[model samples]
Target: MIDCTRAMETNDAPATIAVPQDDALRALLAAIVDCSDDAIVSKTLDGVITSWNRGAEALFGYAAAEAVGQHIYLIIPDDHRAEEDEVLARLRRGERIDHFETVRQTKDGRRIPISLTVSPVRNAAGRIIGASKVARDITERQQSEALRARLAAIVDFSDDAIVSKTLDGVITSWNRGAERLFGYTAAEAVGRHIFLIIPADRRAEEIEVLARLGRGERIEHFDTIRQAKNGHHVAVSLTVSPIKDSRGHIIGASKVARDITERKRAEETLRRAHEELEERVRERTAELSRMNASLRQEIAERLRVEAERTQLLTRLVLAQEEERRRIARDLHDQLGQQLTALRLTLEMLNAQSADQTDVRVQIETLQELARQLDQDVAFRVGELRPVDFEERGLRAVLTDYVRKWSKHSGIPVRLHATPSTGERFTSEVETMLYRLAQEALNNIVKHARAECADVVLERSPEYLSLIVEDNGIGFDLSSVGSIGGGVGLLGMRERAALVGADLQIESTPGRGTTVIVRVPAHAAATRIP
Candidate 1:
């Protein structure tokens, strides 16, 4: 009751009885205003500025006296005026907004992001009057944060791997690009030691890199080898930059690596093929020299024996030719005559035994056997000399060969041949090409685990190209040289060189194999120009 009487007495006191405490009140207000980092301003409900603190004056580029009577919308961007109306309406209703973020116009006409809070002011009778608002500038921090997020997103989704490792060689960060490049997931890579993915033989190189980094040296575009999850070595181009901590100490490294395994392999394959071709040329040249030396030696050593050797060689060649001719003649003459006689005899028997059904059946069987024998003889003769090369064309001859090869090997074969019509080529050239196809097909049937093979013969204006490919288990063409002249391959290459051709074999362990033979068409021409 006594407290109520004192409060009433103090309230009833006259306004003139209040003493001037200007200095103390000023100091108190100054301390309160300085405590805030945001701009604090008081304004009338009609939008005129009433008071301004130091933060408000600095924020608006105006002094307290200059801004006091001005519209508070001077700081509100033109685009945000509609939102300002809602804010004023809310403030007039004695409402307060806390931490409302928006954009504001600065003194230099620059737009700035800010968090604003506005509240209504009251008089002694507690009647809502003017409003005080606090605005905090967040433009720089917001822009910085957004830029960082964008860069991080790019790194996270890049195709070339980006990784970060601690000074102790511990993996600190892994991105999606790293996962694709290294075949490792973020969960499997992060917090793991960097040496986990490096090959044992490459640890020394990694140590050297760390030593360089410790000396504040950054490594850029260092081409090296890295191991994949499946233990295969992959060529990589790496750029390593130092990552500094808050105190500017080089604590870790950020590395960007691109997997160049495929490109490296292709280059290596081309290099190896070139080496093999040069070696083959050297061997062929050497072989030609040896053959020439043998011929010269035979000319000098025994002139009489030279004649004998020539005769012997001639007989050997003639013997082979004669055997083929004799077989062909026997098939055509003896067997053909016997078949004709048997057919005629069967016809006569069938006519005489018209009354005897059992005799007629025997005669019918004889006639059928004779016809089959004649067809068999014709096919054999065709196989011996595929005269289709002269009649139908080289294309037709190759087509027949591919068909027969597929039937014999049980592997499907496809042939694509280009026509070289009116281009007269040597019989030897035709035989060499056909024999190479035969030998390649035999090798594929015996060794290659191929489901399908392709034989493409293209005769261009300058070159005749034959490409034989198989999706089969592949062998190293280089290793074939070490195997010291595989008889079949040697024969094929010999025939190619004899016809002024080049033979190249390309293969990788798991990928497949292709044999390409290119010959100068004019060199192999049989025309007497």
Candidate 2:
């Protein structure tokens, strides 16, 4: 409602009006134009700029003195010059334009977005003289609109359900994500109670959430179950935030629901697997413990049996020695005396028959037979038990035994005795070693067909060793059990064990055979009496 003629001061105005009335009207029009925040200007119908206000100077970067009397097209960009012609044409027809938004150039050639309101200007007779234009800047409004459009696009395309509801728990807005998640269209969901998607038993949750939202509290990632349109339960994680109005008052809430059904199922599977693994571990541990206990019992039983066997072997050896001593005593005391008396009787009979030649020859033959019987008895006694072992030490016994064996068997025998071989040991150790050596020589005579043999008795700081070696036709050691000396070897090993000695046999075909008996010094010293 501005006076266009007074604002522009038209040169064609009449000079007959009262000066005070004109001055007051002109002052009022100037005040209205100066006080407006939008740019206000008046232009002649021919597109000439007639007047400009302070607002126009600020908006278009021009002062009143610089913009007045200039062409209105001076502020119209080259591409939009036809817009000014159209406005002028409309004004010539006495028309007004309301809120015509367009781009206009400033004095510095910067383009500004503005909404223009143009009206035809006239004098008191109502004849059109010029046009008045109002331009308002709308840059901030355009940016806000673009931002809103982008946010709407994101909400519509999100995978998670995004919904907005009033503080009363009634849904106000539903996006595409919400429609897909709940199996409902936006039209069906909007205006409905938000609890429609909650399970019947859990509907009370909505009341609680609404109360919190009213207090402007945000609930983040609240895991819960809900009902789908198909009436099935769905696991979801909900993040609900309070929606505020321009005055900062809580009016509603925005909820984001993410589907977590698969996640829950996977977690349950893992938990079950862990439980099963723990159960298996417990069962296996119990089984192993039982097995370990059984093994301990078995080991104890084996040790007991071994101890009993050692005692039995010791008693058997003692009985054997006693039997040998009894046999030797019988052969020496009874058989030797009888043989001596028989030899003496044969000699006296030969003396009594000296005059009878035939009788003398028969008597001499009887005497010769008696002498052979006595020698046989002595040999048998020596073989039964070598009492020499008790009287003379190991070295003397071995030397006499080996020399007699070599003479009887027609084989060369070499005997090697260490200096300590003369030292006395327990009867059991000496007997065991002597038996082993005897068995070895018997094997060489029966199987080896050897030309020469060696028997060695050596003593070390820790052990006493007896070695019997023969240069004979050897046999495969691997086939010892199947070969000729199986029983003999077993007997040797048994005797060695009784004395706590280690016996080893080494042989190869056509090479030689060697038998070694190694008795620890302490074991030999501690043999049972």
Candidate 3:
């Protein structure tokens, strides 16, 4: 109990008093109020402090002696001074204020959040004269409430499904994220069994999860399938942990489920792609194996045909030379002798017919005809068999052939021979050189409207080279295979190849043509035996 009049007399110390019939109870109540953790105070209707407890002194950072006998505004901040007026007015009206949450000032000039409860104080006559006030610090409570609000917001906005369920598989809480992921609202999912979202095939999985959660075990990134409200399957990766209270007992499980439907689909596509790639590789390997076998067979056949062609060309060349020799022999031996005898017989007839003028004139004309006929046949024989060189070699035959061909074709031809010209070669080499020159000149006459041509023969210690160039309207080298001379060029290459020589034809449109042939010294130096 407080002796209000005595407390009002001096602000130095608290006055002790007693109730009329219950002094001990009054003392206990007074001690309880003074020792309470909340600030308890009393003030007159004029807002003057009449009593201040130790809690008041502790909370406001002022001693009871300093607070008592002062106006209630000693603790009420300037901004909250109006609150005191309303509190006093309510107190005078004998009304009680339950929990007026407001701000108060400590002696140190810091504002502290507090909740105030005020009740009217009345004497034995039941007339209100003063007010009793209790103020409790609510800063920690406010901080805790704000923290919970923020956590709730995070759970509501998360993209992954977050849910809490009791150990018995009953759903306790569902977040907005869970609502979106599972296609069920919080009102629809809460109070429902956890199996509401579990597919039939996955029900056993839920049982295992509950059993594991009962053991206080946490499962991270566990892959599973869940069904949505629409009955579509959702692939999810769940992170579930045991939600424990302050007592450290497993009460429920918290699940964080992420949607992995797209990820799972991507994995399946990659698997199929790998399988297809491997199949294609196997097919390609088989195809390549078959192609290799066929190519080998084709290469072998080409080699055999090429060998046969080489033999045929060699025999053809020899037979053609032999036939030419036979024809020339026939013309020179039979026809030349017979024509010379005829000419002689016609000369004798002319001399013996001196008595007959007209007959003698006819015999003289016949003699002249016979002589010209003999000359024509000899020239034809020389053309058929170019076998005049018993001692002529490669260089001499080529030079002489070039001169004769140019005179025959009326096209100027230049023969550029090295100092080794006229070196006696074997009959084969000599004939090959002659035939090559002949063919080249013949092609010039037929296709090349040339004003001049050059035949160059060069011999080194190791090789021989022939170059034929004409200043004619040249052709495109790229279109050589499509030109009129394509076959002729092929034949020339074949003939050169028979003697182990390299042949090249180089031409360009409007640039003239050049044919080059090179033979190895060992092949060109046909050993004369």
Candidate 4:
């Protein structure tokens, strides 16, 4: 019933069985092949497929039923068929290939990159029977390798130094940036201690950085000092992160360092400039304070001088008043008596010469002449001083003066007096007031072309005031100094100052003039002996 040639072919087929002692072992081996992500296939020495696993069906888009009797070149791309021939030749010589990467064709006509391992299959007698091949798709692994290369290029060209060190502070990798920064090539720096670039005094920084890296921590922008190849110190800002292994364990540290020496120098310069500016401001303030103190002292000295001058003026005014009084007394007591005696003698002579017409006429003329001289002397004495002021009170003196002045000037004058407190003022104060009133009336007669005048004298608890007002053609008060009234106004002001009083003059053209003198109560009561 069986064909002998077909039976022989079936008996020569390679069996997919291993002589394991237990079913568990065999089941595990089967699981390994079926669960693998790589395609596993076995073929005859002549290249006919003998066995195929689930992984092979998934990889080549072919089922075991479709590929078991097929040639091994079914999955080999057309251009890569020569690779298989060489692979088979090596296998025939009992050679094994590991990770031989090449392109192979899937059932969909697309070529896929794969890594392959091939080995010669042996029979129970250790004879080479076929080749077993394992092919793994390597698309994602190739893409990952390309990305890593790009990142390495970026690190090499960075301006800031980029380096990696182990947890034990050994330098593992150094980029071109690190080489330029530290003046060391990667060949020289790698495998050396990372502290080689750190300044001697700052070696402790490396210890701390390594300690932190061991704890899987990142340090960002830590400013510290480092050393260049020339032994000069450089200020640097460092950022360090933990470098991890494939198992996510911290294996080393990655660092980026930027030089900041110029920034530090600029900060120091700005600090010095700020300090100098503050010092200058303080010095200027002190100088201004000194100037202010000096100005205050100068002003105080000027005030003292003004006070002394005022005192001297007051004494001089009192002396001048005394001299006027003395002159008035001499004229009244001595010259007045002499003139009376001379007039009486002339009258007696005229009486004796009554019978002689010529002698009587001459005696009468001499008597008349003596009388006129006596009157003239009395008038001059009154002009020199107010003798009646000493004998009479201020009101009486003022009344007599105003009456006489009104009679002489033919000007109507009114007087008003009110003594609120019956306090008699000092003689000096009374004299000054009388003199001021006299001067004011004289000014009215000379300067104010008016018809009527008024005099007011009042005494209050705080002060004594005298006002002399005239209903006359007023003059410009501002121009009074340039006008002829300046001298009289000056004298009035001087007298007011001597008695510590205030003098005010108010006037306008066509309106009237008012002269007022106010003496404080304390000053009026003060007697200057």
Model 1: residue 18 alpha-carbon error in angstroms: 19
Q: What are the clashing pairs of model 1?
A: none
Q: What is the C-alpha lDDT of each candidate?
A: 0.76, 0.83, 0.81, 0.81
lDDT for model 2 comes to 0.83
What RMSD value applies to candidate 2?
A: 15.3
Task: Residues 1-529, candidate 3: write the lDDT tens digits.
Answer: 4543322211121222222247786676677677677788888889889888887888889998998899988878898888788878877777778778999999999999988878777766677778778888889999999999998899879999999999998899898889998999999999999999999999999999899999888999999999999999999999999999999998999999999999999999999999999999999999999999999999999989988998999897878778878999999999988998898888888889999999998998888888878766865576568564566667776676677677667899988988875566556556666677677766777787889999998888877888899998888878666325423777777778888888888887777888888888888774543
Rank by lDDT (best first): 2, 4, 3, 1
Off by over 4 Å in 1: 1-22, 31-38, 85-99, 107-109, 117-130, 273-529
Q: How far is candidate 3 from the true structure (C-alpha RMSD, Å)?
A: 14.3
lDDT (10s digit) by residue, model 1, range 59-139: 767777887898978888888999989988987777778778998877778777887777777665666677777777778
Model 2 lDDT, residue 295, Cα: 89
Candidate 4: misplaced stretches above 4 Å?
1-32, 122-129, 261-529
In order of appearance, the predictions have TM-scores of 0.44, 0.51, 0.49, 0.44
lDDT of residue 116 for candidate 3: 82
Give candidate 1's TM-score: 0.44
